[model samples]
Target: MGSTGDSGNGKAGWWCRRSSSPSSSSTASSSTPSRTFETRDPRTGDVLAHIAEADKADVDIAVKAAREAFEHGKWPRMSGYERSRVMNKLADLVEQHADELAALDGADAGKLLTLGKIIDMPAAAQMLRYYAGAADKIHGESLRVAGKYQGYTLKEPIGVVGVIIPWNFPTMMFFLKVSPALAAGCTVVVKPAEQTPLSALYYAHLAKLAGVPDGVINVVPGFGPTAGAALSSHMDVDSIAFTGSAEIGRTIMESAARSNLKNVSLELGGKSPMIVFDDADVDMAVSLSTLAVFFNKGEICVAGSRVYVQEGIYDEFVKKAVEAAKNWKVGDPFDAATNMGPQVDKVQFERVLKYIEIGKNEGATLLTGGKPTGDKGYYIEPTIFVDVKEDMTIAQEEIFGPVMSLMKFKTVEEAIEKANCTKYGLAAGIVTKNLNIANMVSRSVRAGTVWVNCYFAFDPDAPFGGFKMSGFGRDQGMVAIDKYLQVKSVITAVPDSPWY
Candidate 1:
């Protein structure tokens, strides 16, 4: 619904304009150049939207606007009930336009429309409503002390926040960061990944419709180095929240330290494992494992890319997994029957392809798909590799594509050790019938989240995050509000107070 054209004097690229450009009579020169980052449909290579690329100047403008809104705008001082009303309104607006948003997401990121509608859209709206409901519930405490007057505590917003969202689940991540920050009375400047900025931009329009004040929520769609770095290091930004790779997470932390030492919350990469025990339900193990790797074309951060099965059931598990992968429909995301879609972009597609090559070169046996399927759209068939060593690149690194590596484990301890092998500890899965094994393995595996028999099960009320190199802090649930707020303790004393 925005203008998709090259606007600047050929110096910058095309930009998506939410409104018509200012009249020529209104201003002589604009400091921020209008540039665009073209988003292509992974299934058809069609131009989805020529998005605007916000440079440092634009980043500054956005940050300043958010800062002003936080410091003086009605949103920051608005009552919790009022904020909740606005957030609920926004959620309703998103629901009203769910179909269009899902279609746009499908075109922009090649995610299945069915999944987007049933899973993503409803989940996103619920997340907004969840956070909205939490707005008025944020409270502080009072402490009683020996030598002080009566006092109480106050929880305050952390000020302007900078959020860097990932390409996968762009809309979800946007609401995850924005809704909570808004509920906590913090204005934000969001930098969406260049690969999937359209839905975010569209959400911006919906935010306006929901009565979110101008400049209260500003989205800067651009490259990470430009808009993202600017948001990360901006002096006006009081906090930074990011969802991306660990490498970039480190960079963001370093930038925060170098700038104003802003509060930072990161949800980084993962090398999650699916441990299938000998006594596990074979059918359930096989089905969940296949969904873990092939779902979302295996672009999920918690995709069970590394599968470790007990040697007793390893052979049968691999056979069933291969067969399951074969049945996955990898084609047009818009098609109602399609289950999987193309990778987000060529860079990610090639990155996954390189990992496939690495798995082969490193002597890991390729059990199924190993090459690109078609010429158009960046499509890779669901791949499964067996006989994979734990040290192989494909086994360790985050391929972020439709690739799975299998290994055999002899015992519960072995499975735990193998599952915790990678530096990432985002999530893990365990499939077993024995409650003892489940309890032992669940405690043994060091991940932020563990699924007993399911994968990618998300609830708005549940807390989600990672541990170790997977990054810190939690998202969703009441815990998410902690990162967006600062606490101040108060003390109270009896009649005679020595210190006041």
Candidate 2:
């Protein structure tokens, strides 16, 4: 099992080894019999591997390592071009081990191997490369002032970042937070979600191989409340970057305020709307709408959970959508033809099932697929509901599953009204040939991203995040650098002071 080369321990397979050499205290703590977790394949419910669950003590070790690397090591003080070289190397390695990494992702998260191998992993490496190019461009601004004193702003690294990643897209979220932090010269202690910790640890090994200094990127595989909370509230951490739910984002913000007042950036959950007008391309809408929700079994944060159709076209749209949903092949994730896969774990499986019941109890008419599929893995049918009122629980909540609640609207105004009613503002979509309607609704809707005539269109150049309860701060693009960097204004007198 020992060969994904350049890993510190050379112990590969499903097992991920710790990167840094532990202190004597850490060594003692490692042997104290902490709680552990077994990662199982969501498709088969078979044990994939086991990881040591970290607590507050383990978080302290990782945070201290990151602090030391940021404060005293050569990484933060290195030239931008030099850091860029390491980042670029990381991107290259991601491509090199794409298959192995993709398989690990499939086994750990029940992601379809085809999707992971083809889309998710490649996109992650591309995102890293995008951030790598920005490394050399991180510089202070020159001053042009009227006074005798010269003033300019310095863009410097915010030391010791704490990154908490979500399980939905493990590889992407890891680079989404870690890439820019590394580009900005900040060291990071990452606590990946308990459900999918293997890939994050594996990424740490790849970073080490790519020439990132040992302490610059540390991985502590653990749960949110213990390791995550400790990192958020630790006095040494200069900032915390998180991607998860709105409720958890609040706890992180409060922890930041009460601790060292660390900077906090969040990308939270969503109940994004996908609106279809009477004159739109119904076939195109049917296709993209299916991809939007059922692409990852609706595990995405921006999944189009609330779909609104003009009343004239509501009946027709529902018919085509259900017909398209029937073709989404759900089975073993490793199969090349499988487009849909199992939910990540038992909790999420139960949660999505509970919401299906809520839709029934709340009076939404179930059009098709309101039941679980097989008896083995946590697989559920790609469900759809029609005649859903905006006030229904299924229509309002962030049901992160392969479920779509179809609602009818009389006008564009009505569509916009019902779309923005949710507490979430992560993303929304518009499908119509009318440019006027597209521009009007795009400007009016309260979302971080609006897809016109399309759904789930994303680029590294575009800054992505949400408004209101969905959370603050942007990820990807140039704006992401602002989160990891602090601006310092320096002023120096060119002449003698007036007092003198």
Candidate 3:
């Protein structure tokens, strides 16, 4: 309802100095009226700050700066060890300002402060450190050839990379894309989601402080249709690493094909299923399954929204799940005890509500929480639906909210069949003590990553991506860095060899 403070100072301390150059110190002219948008606190529907919207012109400048850095700046020319030192310094800066960074996401994105501090911010720093450790490990391989020739492969940076991150998990996604790109000696122009740009701008400031060249990393905060479009379609950009919806991923691919055919890596949407076998610990299964769908207010791309339990535990699991949903805390993100926060904004809030109505109309029984909570803010109660047919809208579409669909499966075959029914194949969780069942389901499922007894267990070492419509290209691990790199083969006939 009211302004929190200036974007540069006061309660919300996110720096917002806009400029066309790569310098973080440069500022836009506020005196002249230009296109702007209000970023709000989802917890209160209050304006956090008025952010300068970056259009196609702004995107062009950022891309040009990245290109300049990649071509002539010290960053790309620096040895891998030298680059690693700088990136590790940036990671140190992230840890030093961890709480402040956590708070920025809390106020700007309705992310729970506890989760931000413990999980989001720390993982961001860890990502930087993980990639930093791998910076020097990027190497070419000596190849054996059929002819008498010396042959090897060269692993080189893929030039300027344009990264577009989504609002959900803003800080984590920022580092997820940018860290690996930087480690590969690639200059990056990142356009953070307009809804949550505070942490990204802060990271840009940290990069400069950590001895990175000015143009090596640039942050342009703007809307998807404009700045995002420009970056995806830019001819000079060598690659585009994006994390968002499948629909938008298609648009980016189309743009890439129409442009310079830049390399594109996407981590898109999912309606992931968590299978609970009859032998599972019911209490543990309930706890993990509840967290699977409700964590991050069910905004996660790998959310286990569609859960299938064996018929032996179907009624018991349903009863416990309803109780779990009812007990899930939906309140202010700043509250230490609050596990779930509000929807990112009114649009997301309304979208979740619309799906709840759709579920009710589709004849699914609402066991608990089908309505909004609190007088203000975009809070929705944890919703659970039963009798969800496989073809039902709630079972089929990805409703990115705190909504769960509990379906019963009589056998492992049915569970696997139902799980693979969706077009999405991002991630899934299987809960079973039987090794055979776990192995069968894990192998049979079409998703990219499968958890045996856990949900949302992610590490820097594990490669993450999607298989069908969920989009392609791994996000973490050594493979992720390869996406931002190009392989060049070098061969020459041995001077003294018979072939020569």
Candidate 4:
């Protein structure tokens, strides 16, 4: 395992600190205890910035601000087309500052800047624009009943929402949770992960530029117990949206019930499976699986870390996967050529290492990279473990690292059984050329999203939420707005006096 360093004050020491200009200086109220979270460059361990922590009082203030904006501000009351204009302006601002946003995301979470710019930032902005276009398109339906009256339904905003984002893709998650919430005429209080909160705080400034009213989108950066728990359990908060571990998701659900039975949407953990059959295209499966686990250092919630291959082609797949894992360049996130960056922080790095050690102890063969490379930074080599059983910890648990556990299956039924063995039902992928097999496996898998030939494929127009323990409510698409609004039916009598 990697060495652990305690900063005495409960702060992670590896964070980087960057110099800030005078214009960036803003303080919370005197009553709120001011604390700082340091940001670090994962490649060099250099300080990027020290961001202020928003405590419970700060969360309260942010939520109150959002509530005030929703109830009284002009933002929620603006016409959908008018709101679309603001969203478009926000999209323009995002494009103008794409480089900056990518850089901040890279420095904060060690995501590849090239991919962050080419994929994450543009996709994020597009999500904003897509939801912005839909802002005016939210429609309610009229009921045709056997009565002398006419009835229609209205979808109205639920009120203040609290969005707690994970660290893997902080900037994207921020927009994914915030954009639609605002478009639905709901206010938001965001609590970004403490490990990577700088970019989210930076976004508060951007939201202001996008003409978002004060408190409509407020960001509070602090520990999960402090700011996150407060927001999830706050009685004034009408809904809570979270993306993180399953344990935390359950906690949030409990907190919501303890508060006001607030509407909750959770995109939680996954031990997603990727099955490659004998008839599948070997190279493409290898490529997709590599991208699935190694992208973002395999920190993604929907990472296809568990790969099951048919016995006839298992060796070929393993060899190809090992070679692909070796080619993943682990270096500074800022470098365009770098394919894999360091884990988000040291704790995460060590956690991944601990899991690798567990795999070794459980008699799983470590086929490829397992230890950290380079003298500095929190870089773990892309690890591949073969001879893994469905019962092994490596295959059952969510590692959230660049570790792939290879399991072999003899028949289609065995593969399906193993794939659906875990508590997670988030996402899964199947690689095969046979249409019958594809259709059968797709129907059998208990995941929310199943990819027939691809992995990690996402769109703003699609509804994404897990089935079982993975939690409830969708994040993107038209259904996402449903969680933020209430449905009410209005009935009026016709001019005919016979009904009276």
Q: lDDT scores for all predictions?
A: 0.84, 0.84, 0.87, 0.83
Q: Give the per-residue lDDT of model 4 (tens digit) for 139-224.
A: 78998745688889988888998999999998889889988887888888888888888777666766667776556767777789
State the lDDT of candidate 3 residue by residue for 380-462, as single tens digits: 99999999999999988889999999999999999999999999999999999999999999999999999989988999999
Poorest 10 consecutive residues of model 1 by lDDT? Answer: 1-10
Residue runs of model 3 more than 4 Å from their true location after superposition? 1-33, 498-500
Q: How far is 492's C-alpha from truth in model 4 (Å)?
A: 2.5
What RMSD value applies to candidate 1?
4.4
Residue 427 accuracy (lDDT) in model 3: 94
TM-score of 4: 0.93
Which candidate number would show the highest TM-score if scored against the true structure?
Answer: 3
Model 1 has how many clashing residue pairs? 2
Tell me the TM-score of each prediction against the true structure: 0.93, 0.93, 0.94, 0.93
Task: Count the clashes in each prediction.
Answer: 2, 0, 1, 12
What's the candidate order when arranged by decreasing lDDT?
3, 2, 1, 4
Candidate 3: give the clashing pairs. Answer: 1-46
